[model samples]
Target: MRRRAADYRRPARRRLSCWIWGLLVIFSVAGFALFVLHHNQHQEDHVEQTALETNTKNERVVHKHLNFTEEILSVRSYARQLAEQMTLAKAYVIIAKEHNNFHLAWELSSKIRSCQSLLSKAAKKNEPVSLDDAGPIIRSLSSLIFKAQDAYYDIATTMITMKSHIQALEKLANVATVQSTVFGQLAAESVPKNLQCIYIKLTAIWLEKNSLRELADERRNSLQLVDNNLYHFCLFSDNLLAVSVVVNSTVSNADHPKQLVFHIVTNGVKYGAMQAWFLGNDFKGATLEVQNIEDFSWLNASYSPVLKQINDEDLQRSYFERTKDMSLEPKLRNPKYVSLLNHLRFYIPEIYPLLEKVVFLDDDVVVQKDLTPLFSLDLHGNVNGAVETCLESFHRFYKYLNFSNPIISTKFDPQACGWAFGLNVFDLIAWRKENVTALYHYWQEQNADGSLWKLGTLPPGFLAFYGLTEPLDRRWHVLGLGYDLNIDNHLIETAAVIHFNGNMKPWLKLGIGRLVCSTSNSHYPEKLSTTLPQIINGSMVIDAKGPRRSLKVRRKMSSLKYAIKGNQFKIRHDIVVSIQRKSKREM
Candidate 1:
C-alpha cells in the first residue's frame, strides 16, 4: 500500500522532467541556428546591395562616356539647321521685295528677325548652358551675324545693290561660316565630325563586326569548348599525320646516273623561309642551293647562320648531267638579272652543258619534314612551264582589268595573266639561250617601272610566252603569307610550299621572327649577326673581299671579292661581279 502511493507522483514527475528537458534542448539549438543564419544573411544582403549599387553607378558613367561625341554631332546639326533657316529667311525676304508686297516683306522680315534671334539665343545658350563650352563660337557667330546682316540688307531694289551685298559677304567671311564660328569648327576640318568620320564608321561597323565576334566568342566558349573537351576525353593527340616537300627534277647527263633537284626559297627576309623550313621537313630530296659567290654572299650576309655544306662533286655532276641537254641558252646569254645571268652564261656555248634545276630560296621559312616526293612527282607532262599554277583562273585577273579575250588578241596580256609565284621548275638551259632572254628583260623592265610582280606573277608570264596550258593538282605549291594559326583551321592540316609574302622578312633584323626565321643559326658566328636581314639594322659593309670569312683566304684572284658595302654584306650578284672583275684585272 505504501509503495503504490509513492509511485503515482514519481511517474508524473518523470514525464514532466523528460518533456521540459527535450523542449529546452530544442529551443537552444533552434536559437543558435537562427542567430547564425540571420547574421550571415544580413551580411550577404549588404554585400549584394553594395555591389549592385556600384554596378549601377558604373553603368551610368559609362553610358555618358560618349557625350563628347554626341555633343559635337548635335552642335554640328543644330548649327547647320540654323544656317539653313537663316538662308531661307533671306531668300523669302528677297522674293517678297521682288514682288513689291510690303505687307509680305514686313511679315517675312519679322520671321527673319525671329530666326536671327533664335540663332543668337541658341548660340548663347550652348555656350554656358549644358553640354559644351562654345564661347568662341558665340563670339564668332555674333561678328559673322553683323557682317551677314550688312550683306543681307544691302540687297536693294536694283542689281547694283545685290552686287554690293555679295561683295560685303565676301569681305566679311572667308568660309561662309563667320556666324557662330565659335560654336563648332568646320573651317580647319579639325572638328571631330569632319575629320573623324572613320571613327564613327568604325564604331558602327564594329558593332556589326562585334556582333559576329560575340557570336563567335559564344560558340567558342560554349559549343567549341564542349566539343574540344569531349574530343580530348575520347582521344589522345596525334592530329598531325605527316609533312613532305616535293622537288621537280630533271634527268642527269647521259653519262651521270644521279638526278639533281633544287629548293627555291626566300632568306634574309626569311618570313617565307622559316615557315618553309618548319613545314617543309616533310619534303624529300629537297636541298637548298645558294649557287654562285654572289648568291652565297647574300646567303652568308643576310642569312649568316646558314651552314655551307662541303661541295658534293657527285651531286654537282648529277646536276650538270641533267641540265646538259636542256635548252636554256637564251636566258644565260641575255640574262635580265645580269649578275645571275652572267655567272651561269659563261658556258652557254658548250654543247650538252650541265643546266641543273636549282630552287632559288629566300631565307624565310621552316621545314617540318623531308620534301622529296612532292618535288619528284611526275605530273604526266601537265606543266606548261617547268612549274605550273593551274589553280589560278586567268579570268579573275583579266576580268578586273576589263581585258576581254576579244579585245587583246595576245593571250599573254597581264589582264589574262595567270599565276606568277617563285616556286618554279623551268628549263635553265632554254632560259640561258636568247630565245627566252627577252622575257626576263621584259620582267626586269616591268619591275623597274614599280609594279614588281609578286612570287605568283612570274610563272604565268613564262608559261604564257611558251603557250603552256598545264592543269595540275592544286596542292603542289601553296601561298605561305599571313598564315594565322588561330583563325585558319586548315593551316596545320596540309603541307606544300608556303610563300612568306610581306614587307618584312622573318629573318630580317627588325623582324619578330614569328612569320619566318633563319635556318643558318648554328653556321653563322655571332659577329656575323648583322648579315642578310640584319643588314638594314647595321651600317652597310662592302668587304668586296670574301664574304665574312671565319679565316681570311690569301689574296688569290678570287680573294678580294667579298661583297661587303660598308658595314653590311652585299648579297646581290652584281656587286660580286664588279669586285671579281676589278680583282682579276689588278692580278
Candidate 2:
C-alpha cells in the first residue's frame, strides 16, 4: 500500500511540473511578440503624425531651397569647374600635339569635346549636367532670353568665372605654340546663324522698306474697321507678317469672324506696312482698324513716364552692358531695348475710350481655336483675364523680379504668381474705374531708378493689375514657343493660342521652314504664300557679308541649320492645303 502511493504521487508531480514549464514558455514567447507588435504600431502612428504636421513646413523649406540666389550660385560654381576642366583638357591636347604624340592628343581632344558638349548642354538645353554630383546644376538661358530685361546677365555672371580658366588655357596653348585652334574652330562653327540671320533680315526688310506713303495710299479707305463692335481684339506689333498671321489665324478659326473687330496699334514706321498687308490680305468679314501710335501726338516720351524711363540710355546701359561675362549676341545688347510697341498696350483704355472690353494679343501669338468663349467669360468684375504663370511649376514671380530689393520683396509676394502678357482679355471699363493707367504710370516712375524692378512693361502691369486680374485657363494661351523647340506637340494642338515669346520668331528664315510648321502643323506664310516674294523658297541667309552663294552653300555652311525635312504645304489665308498630288490609282 505504501509503495503504490509513492509511485502515483511521483508520476503526478512530474506531469504537473512539465505542464507548468510548458505553459510558462508559451506565455513568455507570446508576451515578447505582442510587445514588438505594439512598439511597431506606435512607431508607424508617430511617423504618420509627424509627416502630417511637417507637410506645409516642408513646402516652405522647398520654396526657400529653390531660391534664385542659390540656383545662380550653383550654376556659377558648376560652370566654372566645367570651364576649368575643358581648358585643362584643351591645354593637354595642345601639349600632346606639340610633342607629336598623336594618340595622347586625340584622347585629350576627345575629352575636351565631351566637356564642351556637357557645357553647351548646360547653357543651351538647361539640362542639369553633374560636375561632381552634390546635384546637377542647370545654367539655363531660357529665362534670360525670354523673360528678363538683360538676357545676357546670367551669361555674364558665368563668363566672369570662366575668363581666368580660358586665359590660363590660352597661355598654355601659346606656350606650346599650337594655338587653341579647337576653341577657335568651335567659336566659328557652334553659333547657329541661319535662323538668326533670317530673323534679322525679315525684320530689317519690314523696317527699311522706303515706300511707306505709297503703301499707305494703296489701301487708304477700302475697308477700315469701325471699332464699334460689342467685342474687340487689340494688337500691338511692329512686324507686318506677324500681324497678318495673327489676324488670319483668328478670323479663320473664329466661330464668327464677322462679329470680331480688331484694333491694331503699331508704330508709325510699321503702320503703313501693316495697313498694306491687311488691305491686300482677305480677312473674310472681320473689321481691322490700324492706328499709328505716333499719330497720337499726346502719347510721347514725356507723356508716358514709362516711355521716358524706357528711353533713358544711361538707365538702359545699367541693365544692358557689354561685360566680359555677357553673351556677345548682337541682337541682345545692340537692339533697341524693349521696343516702343511692346509698351503701347499699357495705354489700352486711353487708346480705346469707347470699348467696354477688348482682348489684347501680342503679334508673336497665333490663334488656333475659336475665341468667342473668351468674350463670354464672366471675369467676375476683374479687369484682366490672363494665364497665370504660377500654374507652371518652374515659373514664379522670382523668375522676373529682383527679390533682393526690400521694396519688391515686401510689396509683392515672390511666390504670389505672375500672368502672361501675350494674350489678355481686358475690361476697359473696369480698368478706367480702377485708374489702372495712373497706377501703371506711378509704378513706371518708381522703377525709373531701377529700384523696383528691371526692364519690361509686364512688371509694371503686374503692379497695376495685381488684385484685379482674373486667371484664365492655360488652354487659352500656350507660351515658350521661342525658348523650347521640343514643346509638346499635343500642347500646341490643344492650345487656343500659341505664343512665340522669345528671340526665335516663327517668321525668321530659320523659323519659316521649321518652327512654325513644327508647332502649328500649318505652313508659314513665308514658305507658302506671298509673304517674302523676293527671298526664294526661304533659303537666302541675310548675312553681313552680303548675298550668300546658294541654299546648298548655306546648308553646307552649318549642319546645325534645321533642314526643311517635312513635306511642304500651301497655306491660303487660314486654310492649310497638302501640295502633294494624289496618286493616279486613287484618282
Candidate 3:
C-alpha cells in the first residue's frame, strides 16, 4: 500500500516540475527579447545617438544655470548680471522724477518687467542657457541702466495718477459739513494756465481708460460693510453677544473670576467637553445664529446693454440667456435693440437668520454720508420693502406702457410713466406672476422693424405711471446724467442718481467730449484735432459718405473739343482705310 501511494505522488511531482520549467523557459525568452530591444545597438547608423549623452548633460547644466551649484558658471553669472541691471534701472527712476525727460523712464521700466516675465517663462520651460535666457541680453543693455532708472518712477507715477485716482481727499473740519464744504473745493480749484493744457489732456486720457466713480463706489461699499445702516440689527447683535458671555461661564474650568470671565469670552468653554455623567465627549456652543443683511437691488431702470446692439452673436446669446425676463418693450413701440435687465435679491429667513432688509443700488449713483436715513423710510401700512421709483418718481417706460393699453389704468399718462420713475419693492413678487416681460418681448419680436418710431414697451410705463401716480416716500428715482445742473453737482457732490440717458454719454459726439471714469471725468483735446478738419466754414463740395464724381465734371468732359482719352471708336486692324474712319468716329 505504501509503494502504491508513492507511485501516485511521483506522477504529481513530475507534473509540477514540468509546469515550473515551462514558466522559467517563457520568462527567460521574454527577458532575452526585452534585453535585446533595450540595449539597442541600432546607434551604429545614427549620428543623434552619439550626441545624446552630451545633449542630456548640457540640458542638466542649463537647468542649474542660475543656481548656486553648476558645472558651467556662465549661465548663473548671466542671470545675476541681468538682475543687477534691473536694480540699476530702478535706481535711476528714483533720481529723475522731476526732470522733463521723466517719460523716457518708461523704456527701462517696461523692458525690465518684460525681461522678468520672459525669464520666468524660460525657467518654467527649462530652456537652455543662451541669449534667450536674458543674462546675455541684459549684460549688453546694462550700459543704459543708470540713465533709465532716473526718470522711471516719476513718469510711472504720473501716468498712474492720470488714470488710477484713489487719492484720498483730506476733509478739513467736521465730517458733518461735507456736502456744502465739498462744493467750495470744487469751485475753488484753479484751472491750469499752460498753453497746451497738459494736465487737462492727461485727465481726458485717464477718464477714457478707467472708470473712477465706479472704483470709488466699490471702495466705499467695501468699507461700509464694517458699519452700515442697520440700527435695529446692530442692537440685536449686541444683545446676543452679551448672552454668549453668560452661557460660557459654567462650562469653563478657570480658577479666578476675572480669569474665568476672560476664558469664557476668549477661549469659549473647552469645545470638546465631556458630559458630566456620560463617558463620551459633547460639544458646547455649536449651534450658530446668523442675522439677515439688508439687501436691495435697483428695479425697472433702463440698462444700455438691453438697448444697445453688439455685433457679436455669441455674446448676445449669453446675455439673453443670463438675463431673466425683464422686458424692455412697451405695447406701443418696439425698439429692436433695447434690453430689459433684472436680478433677484431677497432676505431668506432660513439662509440669513439675522432679520433685516437690504438695498440694491443702480450703477449710476452716489451715496452721501451713511445710508441710514434711507433705511428708516417706510411706505404706507407696514410695507418694509420699498422702491422709491414706485412712489411715482422714476418712469420713462411706465408712461409708455400706460399709453399702449388705456384700459390698464383710467388715469394713465403715457408721457409720465417710467421715463425715470421707479417701482415698488414688494411688487417684484407680484410683477413676476404676470410674465409682463414675456408679453413685452413677444410684442417687440412680432413688430420689430429696427426703428425707434413706435412705443412697443415704454407705453406700459406711462399707463402704469398715470394709474399709480404717487410721490415716493423718500426722494430718489431714475435720474438723468446731471441734466438739472442746479440739483446735481455730479463730480462734486454725492448723487442719488446719475442717469446715463440714451446716448448723451460724455464720450459721444455730444457732452463736450468728456468721458466718465471710475473716480473722475476726462476731457479730449485731440477731438478738435480730428474733427476740426471737418468743421467746414463754406458750402459743402462733397458729400461725406458718397462717390467723388461731380455732375459738372462729367458734362464738361463730354463737351471737350478733342478726341477722348480711352477709345479709338473704329476698328484699327486693317488697312490704310482705318485713319479716316477713326477721325470720323471721334467727331
Candidate 1 TM-score, C-alpha based: 0.30
The local lDDT score (0 to 100) that residue 550 gets in candidate 1 is: 19
lDDT of each candidate versus the true structure:
0.34, 0.60, 0.33
lDDT at residue 443 of model 3 (Cα atoms): 42
Specify the poorest-scoring 10-residue window by lDDT in model 3.
Answer: 272-281
- Ranked candidates, highest lDDT first: 2, 1, 3
lDDT of prediction 1: 0.34
Q: TM-scores of the models, in the given order?
A: 0.30, 0.56, 0.24
Candidate 1: tens digits of C-alpha lDDT, residues 116-222? 66556655554312212222333333334343444445445435654666777787775455343422221211222211222232223334334434543343333
Candidate 3 deviant stretches above 4 angstroms: 1-356, 382-399, 402-406, 409-470, 473-478, 482-497, 505-587
lDDT of 3 by residue, 309-403 (tens): 33335436533453443242211111122222211122122222332333333322322223334444553333223333433444444433433
- Candidate 1 ranges beyond 4 A from true positions: 1-352, 355-369, 382-408, 413-417, 427-460, 463-466, 469-472, 480-489, 509-587
Better structure of 1 and 3 per TM-score: 1
Counting clashing residue pairs in each candidate, in order, gives 117, 2, 75
TM-score of candidate 2 relative to the true fold: 0.56
Candidate 2 global lDDT:
0.60
- Candidate 2 lDDT by residue in tens digits, 1-587: 46544454578889999999999999999999999989866765553443233223322332322333343345244444445445544544454454576776675566556556666665564444343321121112211112221222355444544575578867987766533332332332232444334344333434554454455455444343434444588888766556766777788777777787888888766555456446434576777777787788888877788678767876466435534544233333423345677788888887877678888998778777788788789999999999987867656777667788887788888887889988898988898999988888887887777666656667888888988999999988989886677777677667888888765565554443344543235433323234332223443342223243344444432322222211121222211011111111122
Superposition error at 172 for model 1 (Å): 28
